[model samples]
Target: MTGNRTHLLLYAVEDLRKPLIQQLLAYPQINYSFADTPSELLFQIAQQPPLLIFCRTTERSRVPTSTPLIILCPTHEYHPAQFIHEPAIVDIVAETDLMRLPFIVLRELREEHAIVRETHRLRTLVEHTPYGVIEVEIDSRQIRWSNKAMHHLFGYSAGEMQNLHIEDLHPNDIHTTIINAFQQMSSGDETPLIHITCLHQDRSTFFAILHRAELTGTGKRSSSSFLPMLLVNTKVSAPCKSMPTGSNSPCARLIKDCTISISAVVGQL
Candidate 1:
């Protein structure tokens, strides 16, 4: 989805910078857009931010919040800190180092493009997969992420399911068993596929195969404190009738519990 536009922006004079423009054109990664005047440059900055910028420093110019700005100026006349302090300008180069512009721009943009690409890939997988996939906080079991299948399966809209919990959908009779299962999963045990009855948003119950894996701190949560895991549940059959209170039916035996790890689901992401 992100490959529709070019990545580079330059604000400079067209006629005088012929030699410099040729050097920039040599790199195939560069998708260059030009803005000759201060007003045009400012408009581009506000409307379409680029990976990198090469322009003459003017009183009207303000660097973008994140895009790397490389000012064109005489080395001796430049005050490096003034532009660097703006929180956007990344470098300043004199005319002598014009050859380095493309390399520096490509290096600056590589990481940004990779992150965008990966995020798009993951979003596509989650939305298209048949199972109801969710990521919940290990300690709270609060739902952090849920795909379309999850919301549809539980009879909740995307907005309604935000900040909801797994317990919110579990039948009250199975609460104690589910809690114990979560405790075991959090302690680092691999849980097998367990069949269970879960409550929908309308208070109806359905049978689903729940799979759990313990995700350590990495990928989505790159902190020591936040250990969120994946929960993948596939609806195996139609909605089942809720059994009478304290009845030992065939459904009771199917009510096992589950948990998961974020790093383990990289392919899913």
Candidate 2:
């Protein structure tokens, strides 16, 4: 599920300037300002840092981390590699609807959640459990599930978390990175995913990850997918990989590498 619009900050060549600005402003949620040069783009991206960015095809970058870059190119500019590659880039090469952009932005945040009416036993188990549990929807901004531990771990009350957009938990400074991840998920460059972070209630930061699930549940509401878990580190990077990849344990599978203490991992001899 996408957003009404992802707030944007633009960096484009002088040629496509006017029309692109006009079209973007029409969507109320999609806020933006301009950066005529890539250098200017980085400065604005860091300062006012937006959800996504749009630039021309002829543009190049020294920006290391990937951000969603909408390529505005001339008719003849469609090269095979350019159009088909990792990190999907949208084009103004042809006339079309950009309705997909907002939707994709909304989807990327892992913000969608619809409260699932669970059996009493299941609901009780979720609440009483010690692990920080989270039930989220992958397609909408709605946060439909969580336990006390989940809310406690982050700085949000159950009501606050429910009302705010999932992206609120993430620092706005890195929103461009988030939007990039969202676009990748939208374009098949990535799969259902989660990463680790820690967040405090007064709005502090910590380690947590998007809960991992391999199946799609029956969507009771729209296209949103039910996500049932989001694990966080009580301690940062006890090596974020809690278990080694390809491990036999289900818990280990969710985590990349199993790391116990020097004594505990190997057993005290």
Could you tell me the lDDT of residue 39 within candidate 2?
Answer: 77
Clashing pairs in 1: 122-269, 212-259, 213-259, 213-260, 213-261, 214-261, 215-260, 215-261
| Per-residue accuracy of model 1 over 1-269 as CA lDDT, tens digit each | 13535466777645436776688767766777778776787788778676677776762265555666777767667677776556666677776667877777777788776777776776565555555766657678667777787887888877777657666767899877766676665565445324567888888777765545323222443333223333445445554445431224433233222222223344454
Over the stretch 1-269, how does candidate 2's per-residue lDDT look in tens digits?
Answer: 12533355566655656666566555555556677776787787667555566655556353324566555454465454656754545334332444444444444333322223223434565565445655555576446776787776775778877775455566777556654554454333423233444446676677554433222223222233655544544455433465433336444443433122211322322
Off by over 4 Å in 2: 1-6, 88-269
Ten residues in sequence with the least summed lDDT for candidate 1:
253-262
The C-alpha RMSD of each candidate to the native structure, in angstroms, is 10.1, 15.9
In candidate 1, how many Å is residue 49 off?
A: 3.0
Scored by lDDT, the top model is 1
Return the top candidate by TM-score: 1
